[model samples]
Target: MAKYLLLIVEAEEAYASAGEAELNEVMEAHNAFAAEVGALGAELLGGEALQPTPTATYLRKTRTDDVHIVDNPAPELKEVVGGYYLIEAPNDEVALAAAKRCPAGFGHVELRPIWSFG
Candidate 1:
């Protein structure tokens, strides 16, 4: 099985203004997706719902051999990674099918294969 990372990208503003009912609906959808993974014979290795971008801390190495730190990515980007799911599937087709079912009401889900070096 190969590991894939499903990035749940979403518009921050949409979630920020979501009401209780909307938030609950999204959560329920995610719960259903998790359940579906196992039923589809895929292994859900791990997953997480991230906090708002403002609460994030980013780091990068500068040309001067120093670590540059920031709070988030480009502020101009309308969408940000809201959550992620690490899943192991039999093939790319299965992973793509799973990604299609993931709910990203405000944006979209990005599927990426994890490279193995061994």
Candidate 2:
């Protein structure tokens, strides 16, 4: 089987404005999504929701041999990555199908295949 990553992207502002009821509904959707993928035979390897983008730290190497660290990666980027899902499937088609079933809620899900030595 091959591994795939479902990168979740969403607008943080939307999340901030959502009420508790909306959040609960989103949670239920995620639960349903989990059941749906399991029924489709997609093995969920691992996944997690990340903290807000403001908590992120970015680093880069400078030409002068100094490593620069910045707390803000891109302040102007309105859409930020919210979470990801790692899944294993027998083939690309199956992986894609599984990704389609993911409940991104207020965001869009991007599906990518994990690099394999084999």
Candidate 3:
């Protein structure tokens, strides 16, 4: 079996700026989707809602063995990676199916293959 990462991106400020009722509804939708994914026998390894983009840090390496670190996300955008799920699935198709059902709140879900050293 292979493990996949379902990265959920969202506009943190936009979400937080919404009305209380709207925020509640959005959260409910996400929770419901998570429950559905769990029912499919996919293991939810771990996930967390990240702090706003302002708190993010970026790092890069150069050919001369130089490393650069910055205090911003790469390709700045209104939406940033808010959370993620590590799941075991039979194939990419199954992982994509789950990603499609994620409640992104006008954002996006990126499905990436997890690289295993073993």
| Model 3 ranges with Cα > 4 A deviation | 59-76
For every model shown, what is its TM-score relative to the native structure?
0.91, 0.90, 0.79
Please write out the lDDT profile of model 3 over residues 1-118, one tens digit for every residue. Answer: 7899888887787876799999899889878877888677565666667777767767777555788886664666777788877777777877778788777875889899999897
Model 2 lDDT per residue over 16-77, tens place: 89999998988897778777877777898888888988778788886657889876867888
Q: Whole-model lDDT for model 2 versus the true structure?
A: 0.85
RMSD of each: 1.8, 2.0, 2.7
Candidate 3: residue 33 Cα off by (Å): 2.0
The CA lDDT at 73 in model 1 is 62
Model number with the top TM-score: 1
Candidate 2 worst ten-residue window by lDDT:
62-71
- Backbone-clash count (model 3): 0
Please give the distance, in angstroms, between residue 118's alpha carbon in candidate 3 and its true position after superposition.
1.7
Model 2 clash tally, residue pairs: 0
lDDT of 1 at 77: 96
How far off is model 3, as Cα RMSD? 2.7
